[model samples]
Target chain A: MRYAMVIDTLKCVGCSDCVVACQTENDVPHGYCRDWVTESVIGTYPEVEIELRSERCNHCDNTPCVRTCPTAASHVIEGGIVLVDRDLCIGCGACIESCPYDARYRHPEWGTVDKCTFCVHRVHKGQDPACVSVCPTNCMYFGDIDDANSEVSKLIAVRKYKTLAPEAGTKPQIYYLI
Target chain B: MIPFQISGSEEVFISGRNIPHIDPHLTLWEFPISLYLFLGGLSAGILFFSAVVHLINKEDEFKGAAKWAPIVVPFALSIGLLALVYDLGNPFYSWRLYTTIRLESPMSWGAWVLLIVTPLSILWVMTYIRELFPVIKYENYKMPFLYKVEELAVKYKKYMALALLPLTIILGIYTGILLSAFNARPLWNNAILGPLFLVSGLSTAAATIILFAKSHHERQWFSKIDILLIVIEIGLIIHLIMGYYAGNEMQIEALDVLMNGEFTTMFFGLLVVLGLLVPLILEVFELAGFKVPVIIPAILILIGGLIFRILMVEAGQLSRILY
Candidate 1:
């Protein structure tokens, strides 16, 4: 199943609750984060416009990280979720350079790369990811996009959305609804 | 309405709570990686030229290039590999690199090539050990095993040269491909990086040979080759910059990092002028019977070669496709 995440820019308040939820759920190091909140302001004075986005790993279909990994430490599993096998990872940092989103980080403790796993542990237990469950505004939608009736698929189908760095040809799974 | 007017200029500001390495700049690869690339390229170039001289049966006339030069490859490669391992976050798990070969990965290709080439270089050196070390007689030292191995190596020396010819080229090109494979970095995404690095590697190797080749004829021969390689390197640099200038917004921004940003002075002053241009003129004049101290141009080229890799790694990391 091809899983996807759809985040609505209009609904997000840039509170960064998702970032905190991800850190707590995954036990990410204190100084590092798997997801982040971005605020962009455009134009001048009266014509100014603002956009807020909560971003994370796109879990790209054509994964450059996976393609460039020498030891096959980075791979895609069931549900199109990209994960790293830390044991196999030599911590070469090649994957970090390959990622346009800058999603992955070298775990200082494990000495291997780490990134958002979409809380696959919770997904396997038939529960939403911690960030999705903790998001007060309910701006983030996560589900199998291949299933036509899935919430993520339906939201993406109806909304005017864009993915980050589409020109990168990675076919990112995260859709940002504007 | 207020008396003062608000600026009508369009402005875009982005604020992200991204982590350190991912946000302000990519500090993932550091000086170790730069040194690794430089040394790897140097080793490749030495082996390439040495193999070519051997294959052409010029070993008698160009003994420095064919024999003495290759002895440095093993040592250079060892040091480069050490730098690579030192840069790794989990050095213990580095052995996993050989468990499988991912054909699409330039890194995998490099790891495998290094594994094979390192041993091949040692074998090549072993064949010439007797000549290199005249004082140490294997029979007197009771190392008949080494003597036998050397005899076999000499017998298969031509075959080794044939094998090394293509492998060295791959290793040289692989140094640049390692960076260029990352599409995330605009400055490294260009295809010209492969050939540019290969030529730079060859030029550096020629300079290195010019430094220690005892024969005046050998020094002059390498000096002439370095001059040609330098010209080609300049041409490649021009095309690389021109390509970036004519590219999309991201590429133009990458070009700006080299031309008008933090690396501008180092790129133009150190690498272009002192590293390449100065050495080019010195070598040219030396060829015209001028008494140019060979060490000056040779040392400059070596330093320039190293600086080029450092600047590329550092500047490429800064020129991301997205902020």
Candidate 2:
């Protein structure tokens, strides 16, 4: 069963609680993040509208990070959660180079490549990711795409969703609702 | 957490969260490590090239290059490996580079290439060492088996030359491809980089030959080759710069960064002037009626080539306009 996060940008408050939750849950290094928020303002003066984008590993169906990693240290898991094996990672930064989204980072302490694992450690035990659980505005939806009754599947059926950089051909599992 | 400042306009925000973005100042550190890698690979490839050509032609003028190529290529490669290790935070775990093979990745290709070429090149050198050094030929004691191997190298020099040529071309071009793979990074995504790197390999290879050639005849012939390589390199630079100029805003911005931003001085001062210009001027002098030695120009060109790689890598990484 594939798992994915569908983020509704109109519903997002830009609170950064998800960023905090993901970092604390994963113990990610300083100056590096598995999840990040970017804000873009369109138009000038009174007509301006703010667009917020939260980015992480797309958990691509055809992951470029895996293709670019010299060692099999970076690979996609069963749910298509692209994860890095810290023990096997040489901290070469090649995966970082290969990733178009710039979702991964070389950890200062671990000295290995690290990225969003979809909180796999938590998801493996049948729980929502820290970001999904902690999100105050209910902007994040996480569930198995395989289950027709799952919340994510139901949301995908009902909502208009889009993926970032669709031209990249990676088939990102993360869906954004505009 | 900083607020956007617009002149002659009141502060306006539709949402509670402020728009925050990284300043242009925050970029990946200009790590000098890649330069070492590029230079080492170029030097090794060039030396290997010189070795192959000299081994085939076997002219008296090319003998010094033939002898030095085997010694110098491996040494430069060893130094490149050391530089890469030094750049790593965990050098001990560098072995992990060899643990996998993802053909699509340049690093993966490079890692495997290095792994195979380094040892093979070293063995290739060892196979010819006794011939290069007369002292090794008449050592106090020698094995008959070793003599048989030496006989083999002499017999198969043509085959070894053919093998080393393709390997050298691959080594030279792969570095350029590594930089070009980052398509999002427009500064480095140019197709010309492969040819640029090929010329760089030739340029540095000639520099190395000039640095070590013991005989006047060998030095003169190599200097001619070095001068030719330098000319070709200048032509490639002009072509690349023209491409950069005529491209889109991103490419133009990148060129601006190299021509007028923080990296401007280094790019023009070190890479263009010290590296390319001075060396070219010196070569021109020798080509004209001047009687100066080629040693100074060779040294300048060598230093220039090293600095050129460093500047290109740094400028490319630092000038990224991430949206």
Candidate 3:
């Protein structure tokens, strides 16, 4: 029941619908975001190639955030969902420093570190993440990658995809197909 | 037509003019964390100096700092602990840190280590209470419990030394390992940080003793040790920088920040000159039969130790894979 996400880079248009949906669903603060878009442009003068990526917590198998957490506040739950027990969080920001992706942000009001939960609240209820559901281009895929017949598993089986910061060796759940 | 060649490379190819300015600043662990690292090392430094002086019994001057060392440990450590709690998002619930332990996490080991170190330091200090504070002397006839406790403490004093040396050493290295565990920051990812910080902590702690030393001989002895520690520290700093520079492009960029980026003035000027080298030169002069105020070099070393923590914290935060 390990959940994961696969984002199709070629299909995305940098519309940021996923960003808005994530914010509204999570009640993310005005200045902070649960997930955000990154734009990388290459080439000089008229010959230009641009890539836009939607980034968030990788929920890695070898999670540095969980390992670096002084309190067991950041823990991996049953479904490989990395969660922060806000009630227990001391908010030392060690997890923030340890993350290569810079995914987690200190919750200003909540006084704890916060990040994308993959809409775990919705997933348990048999629904898609707010970002995946609201993505206008249907570029975001969310499913149980462990299930051989799942759409995410099929996508991985069929296409060549890459995860962010592989050098980190975190084995990120999110995949990007360029 | 892009030159992008690898997957998950530590670079983003940008040939366009719209490359957003990378902020020269970013930090997650702020003032409190840096102070904790500094004070923690200082506490360990004091403990190490006191223990060594106690073992050697060569100079009564060092005995002065040994008298204060036990008392200083709880005082400085309490402040450090307070800073840690204050930095927490949930200070009230920080006891949850003790609920479980993760060996892989230096933070968890650090917490537990401090927890045990407090009581052990108190017990060690109890053994020296008669010598350190004659006003509170315990008569065997009047206070049998105090006499019994003192007897046991004196009896097991050698064991106490064994316990404290490793604990203080661990305490010193723990501060460095805490940051080194964060593999994301190339600046802190160096393996030499443990030794580097240990030397910094010891040298600074040595300076603290020399500051309070009443006799010239006592000041001279620790000053000699300080000169050696300072030299080792300089070597470690060079090694730390070279490790980053010799790394990949991302690592090289991180080293550039430490070398000549926004941290240039602080790293090279305050940390290198005023903090380390000045004190080293002065101490060398003092050691070579030259008369110089011992307090000046001692003050400089202490300031340098503090700046080392602040600059290390800031520079590591500034060097990141993403923002």
Instruction: List the candidates ranked by DockQ, beginning with the highest.
Output: 1, 3, 2
**Candidate 2, TM-score of its B chain:** 0.82
- When candidate 3 is compared with the true two-chain complex, its DockQ is 0.46
lDDT of 3 by residue, B1-323 (tens): 23222233322422222212211233767778888888899888887777776776643656646765556778788889999989887678788889988888898899999998876676677877777667875664587587788778778876777778889999999999998888888788778888888899998888888876767877888899899999999999988877776788778877877787888898989889998999999999988889898889999998888888988888888776542
Q: For each candidate, what TM-score against the reference?
A: 0.96, 0.85, 0.91
**Cα lDDT for residue A15, model 2?**
80
Q: What is the lDDT of residue B243 in candidate 3?
A: 79
Q: Model 2, B60: alpha-carbon shift in Å?
A: 2.4
Using lDDT as the measure, the top candidate is 1
Error of 1 at B275 (Å): 0.9
lDDT of 2 by residue, B1-323 (tens): 44333232222323223312122222332444666556655655565655565566863557556666557677778888787776664567888777666778877777777776776566566666765676775346756576776667667766766777777777777777777776545677789988788787778778777777777777767777777887888898889989989986667877876888877888788878888788777777776658867778777777777777777777776544233
Ranking by lDDT: 1, 3, 2
Each model's lDDT comes to 0.90, 0.72, 0.81
* TM-score of candidate 1 to 2 decimals: 0.96
Where in model 3 is the C-alpha error above 4 Å?
B1-26, B57-61, B133-155
Measured by DockQ, the strongest candidate is 1
